[model samples]
Target: MTDVRSDDRPTESLRDRIATELGRARDRSVRLTEAVDDDDLVRQHSPIMSPLVWDLAHIGNQEELWLLRDVGGRTPVRQDIDELYDAFKHPRKDRPALPLLGPTEARRYVGTVRDKVFDLLDGVRFEGRRLVTDGFAFGMIAQHEQQHDETMLATHQLRAGPPVLSAPPPPPSVRPVGAEVLVPAGRFTMGTSTDPWALDNERPGHPVDLPAYVIDAAPVTNAAYLAFVDDGGYADPRWWSGPGWQHRSSAGLTAPMHWRRDGTGWGCTRFGRYAPLVPDEPVVHVGYHEAEAYAAWAGKRLPTEAEWEKAARWDPVSGRSRRYPWGDEDPTPEHANLGQRHLAPAPVGAYPAGASPLGVHQLIGDVWEWTASPFLGYPGFAAFPYREYSEVFFGSDYRVLRGGSFGTDPVACRGTFRNWDLPIRRQIFSGFRCARDARPDETA
Candidate 1:
């Protein structure tokens, strides 16, 4: 993961991280289109998640706009951008469709922009200007699009049919679990917390005191969740939110998305892998509504962002914040189940070293955990222009999720980071863990 430029300055790391992020974006982009149909390409569900076809061009333009046009000060990849899939403004659903990039042309567009991003990143330095903002822009978009790639993998199947992801199911992991403990609430910081590698909204860390509570020693898993299903949990409307009950009643969600029974056991089919769902494997691909339903069923709840941060806090001085639970050291086969040849989710509880201090296993990778929070800025938050990132979605319908999944690059998950999605979106690389009241008296 060497940045082409080897500068001695601190920005060297920024350069390196960007290099990694951009490279990952390109890697996932291929997956986005591979399993999709040409006709279904422009079918967009939401603005944040646009038509698969239009989304490709939008992503390419995004990189050029921020990294090249704004930050690097280059002539845009294309002039008259509005005529050619501009993401800066929303696509009016009623507007007559203009001629758009075909799959071939759009692929070229992304390729052209990606090459420029890496080239420009090699030599640039964000000195007096807002380096942090620029860094987040690059990191967030790369991470953001990767999430989209996960969606395309499944949704494209609905549109046409998805390719069987050749990647095998990840190997099961084994490691010692971290300690489980309750956090005593004091005047602790809430809202977005910043590490050197944080999204813009996560910056300017501020404080929000919380109450003392106990969090899960490990994320909730397929094993534990099976017990819920085995108990006829879905049949009981009492366990579901009103919205969840409506959706489940209408859609008939008897089990987690992609889950199927294998004899008396359960397993999931993801990106073409049909392995037995390890009981300890973290439950994945469930939407916010689904996660909430499970929590209510279990008489527990999803952690608030503040509660999540309290459980997964890092020591800035120790430099452990960079990603791997132990530190910035590259992930080994032992510390976490990431960057492996398998290229898909492993069994949960496999990587004990990756656990949070409270013994929350697999907090950093394996799967993106759904939280009860929504995607919003901290108190007194302000978004940058080219404002689509946070502003468009603020106070909206999106629900927040955390951690990164197996499809995610190792660097993408950060403690206290936030990811948002709709309540019913089971197509992405998403999952859930459980939390509950600290006191036995408070337990539901």
Candidate 2:
């Protein structure tokens, strides 16, 4: 993990910044709640999950615990704040009974504590001693709030809460997009050789071959896959693989993880915000089971990692390997909808300039595509110098996934970087495009 040094202004005096962040967190809480109703706020899919209102309280409680009491050495706020919001004890259930202040009072609590902590920090003159407690407290608070941000998205995707939309995502642009065309059968190196950010399983840069095949021009989108769902895709067992069938049955997945059908067209629900679903944006949060079922229903299959890379990026227009689909010149805004701007996947085909040689619309960003490959070490693959890296799950439960998502740091993202997860998992940032053995005419 990168160790971030405390900023030069670590002295407790910067009450202003803390106050700003506290208010910002409260503002975010209000925005997240704007679309959700009391009934919806109380709903949850899993037993352990907390309510949005509870989440807001915990966010403040965490801030107070770390920055106020721990670092600033101030008398603790109402002692109940710890008992109410303590994640280690409370786990997931939302208890409105935790003595949480009303929205107005919660905002005040956060703001006041922030001001006091900052005021304390400004006066402390350390003999250059690392303020480990203070530094960790700040970082921990940041992480705590970030977890809520994710929970906000997860709650929306699950549709456990009523429909909500705080911000309307920008409309999809008027850009014509193309799909991943065919690549000829051939052998090529797939997976990362260097520690170009190798996940635990992508080590050993395995060489794999692809028979002639066609891949989807891009990821399966809300519009395209909706046809399968409309045709009773979920109810049909024949369309799912053995394991996929079991998963679908248990999870009771009926639609793309992030989509909520409003009226006729679909809109994505995340962070309690709903926007018109991009007809061409990759359907996200659907795990391997959903991806497989979609492929079977559509009479296509996911590409093997080699096949996916071969068609989408490997056969680059230039012979040299570039980190991204377009070329090696890192990424700019137009190149892909990375960064945290929308804080969610862009509509597919938004990044035409970033298309791969095969005309794949979003070869790099928007959603991390699931491939047919299993997570495994490569031939002659050894774990990197970092011991916990690749050796843990050689032939374990994880499956291979590729292409980073919209929220990913584009600098760390690349065509070859690999990620993995258990098969049953689904969330808003994960999804797969389809690929299949090609008819002779379709092969490159």
Candidate 3:
């Protein structure tokens, strides 16, 4: 909301919107951390993730740094502990021993910071500075918190216990979708230049010319992935890249994470509860290599970042890009399975309403779809506010993922939004759809 049209609003509306977003984000953070006992909050569920208590405090620290200190010109509330919460200063594996604030203290500190932010919001101007312009900093902080909330949700998925979370199931697929959609590619704009809250990596929209291609109408589902597993996809080196094969061999990845043998079919654990795999639901908890291997077995390949964007945002008739697959508007519940409305991905064709104009389905949410591209700044890219936000990670070390996942909050996800992780990571809610060069006749 802050990035879309925040500056166009009256001062009151802008402040109200920012306040609402901040509140919503905090609520999610609280729910995630509070659901578990203090022991669970302080324990590191996985080495790749921080203790839940650390995330709780870090969210407040970021808000204080950007909104209270930088925008409001206020002194730090706890200058001594800044390093304790600085993410770059400490990796997730080392966070638990860094004198992190305990559960009670973490909650109280964030509450204090939030109170000060509200006071500052009452008087902060909407212009005269880039960070404060259009309430970008506030919006950014809200997004940051939501991002951590998603991470904490992932941590919950990794935690060992009875179910600590629950939500109603996502709507079932309304109808069958075709196997693939042809993207009649030409020059289509990529990234964003006008979104008020768009992060640095997503700025400076540019046109990308390309040959036509074919892409999956929906993400690969459990049923489809099952075919790969049944065929010994993991054991076959023919389908995997060199590095991918090495990792698969060492890690002994037989199936998607949390998946185990059910008597007659496959079963998967979600938030500690196990159930039979829903054949039509998009597969989750997959790494890049697994997805790549599956694509190869299917006689296809992962889409390039540009190809994925063209399929999602390009409108053939209008010759323009939209903010989402459905249109320029923010997502509704019916649009996609986002914001943890469902604790897992919906069935492949469940969100036909969210389909792209080219007829691609479930493009915005359900799972983070891996792309062929590595993390890189767009052409003419420039860092803003800080390079650590995106620039520092611009290299082949991390692979790019488009769209958002069921754990993703809408504020932190958008058409141009970029997410990257080490290709070997299997703990996140990730999946993919395959693509291929269009047949000569199909291009027309």
Candidate 4:
């Protein structure tokens, strides 16, 4: 990880950028919550996820913990409720039974925290501790809020009701002529070492050597996944692993979550509205098991974590990695579907400008792509600030997912950022692209 030893302090422009990002994150959270009623906000849509109200207060609680208390050295605003909002202390299924702050109280608490945080940011020095240096604490808090915003979006997708959110459709897809592209054998850097706000898991950039392999030019779309469903892919035990088959059988899942057979066709529910599945859109909410099964059925495999990173960030010409597929510039509307600008994944091959150096489309956004690798730390990995953020989950049980999703904020999304969850999880915005070893007959 980069140490905060530089004498140079934050500039006015830097402060403004941080402030703008924080405001956008907070505003997005409010907009998502406001779209649902108080009853829906308190209702737990799934056992795995917390009630919307718990997340609202949890956002404030975390901002207060990091920005106000840790960075600004302030006393707690509501000391009695800290345990109630502690994620590690309480599980999601039990949170609804807790006495969480109501809508009015939660809004007031978050607003007050924001006020204090902004006040602290105005005059705070940005060169002392790691948390304060380069406004890392503020950036972290903003990212935390934005992450919760994405989680709340998941809640919206799970909630049952008429449409509570809407957005103009994304650009039409141009069906990629080549199904996949060959990434030449090479050594490439896999993570970041200098990004000031990058989390502990993405630190200490390392080298990885990979053989030539072919990866999908775009994510598997609804049209493609539907073919798997139509061919009894789920029922075939040959395509699924032992544990995967058990999970599929127990759940009685024949198709992706939120999808139901409508006579001779299929319809999917998104944010409480059911519509005919969009054939070209990247498939969302598929679990790791399902992604793996689909790959096996297609005579391919999921890309490893290293391979995925190499495909997205490696620049063969320079022998270096860029901060994003499109380069170091922050994301723009034309680059990818992000920041809740759209409630669903854009069509496959839609974001040509966001393509990587090798012409792989949508490498940075649309949905989190499941990889074949398990979630593990690098050779020199060490937890910073706290271990709970990532260290505890580094094991074979959780699968690593790369790229951000439609609800991901640009401030929180990066080429090296890592997300992980259990393989059985299908509620979040997750999908996958297929990969395979280059054949002897194939030429790059």
Which prediction has the highest TM-score against the true structure?
Answer: 3
Q: In candidate 1, how many Å is residue 172 off?
A: 1.9
Q: Report the C-alpha lDDT of model 4 over 331-442, residue by residue, as the tens digit.
A: 9988889988888899887888889889898988899999999989987998887899999999999999999999899988999999999999999999999999999778
The list of candidate 2 runs beyond 4 A from truth reads: 1-171, 195-200, 258-268, 316-318, 385-388
Q: For residues 1-444, what per-residue lDDT tens digits would candidate 1 score against the true structure?
A: 454455554577767767877776677777667655666566654333556776677678777777778778898877555455654444535212656677788889888988887888777765656643447557756766665565555454334244444666666655544424565656555444445556656655677666667667667778778888898988888888898889888988888887999997777775555677777667776777878877888778888877776666643344233333455465666666554235555675577666655455677667778888877778777775435667677675888777666655555556656777778887676777677767865433
lDDT per residue for candidate 2 within 1-444, as digits (tens), equals 135356744433333444444444445556665556665555555554566667766777777766667566788876666776666565565464455566556656766766676676555444342333234334335534644654664555566444454333533755766655777666666666553333434555566765777888778887888888889998999999898888888888888776677898777767555788766667777888888888888888887877777665565445433456786667887887653445566776577788876687777777888887787777777653333434675575777778877655453366777767777877637888888777866643
Clashes per model (N, Cα, C within 3 A): 10, 12, 1, 0
CA lDDT, every model vs. true structure:
0.67, 0.66, 0.93, 0.89
True lDDT of residue 289, candidate 3: 95
Report the Cα lDDT for residue 150, model 2.
49
| Stretches of model 3 off by over 4 angstroms after superposition | 1-9
Best prediction by lDDT: 3
**TM-score for predicted model 2 compared with the true structure:** 0.64
Candidate number with the higher TM-score (3 or 4)? 3
Candidate 3 local lDDT, 336-408, one digit each (tens): 8889888989997788789998899998989999999999999999998898899999999899999999999
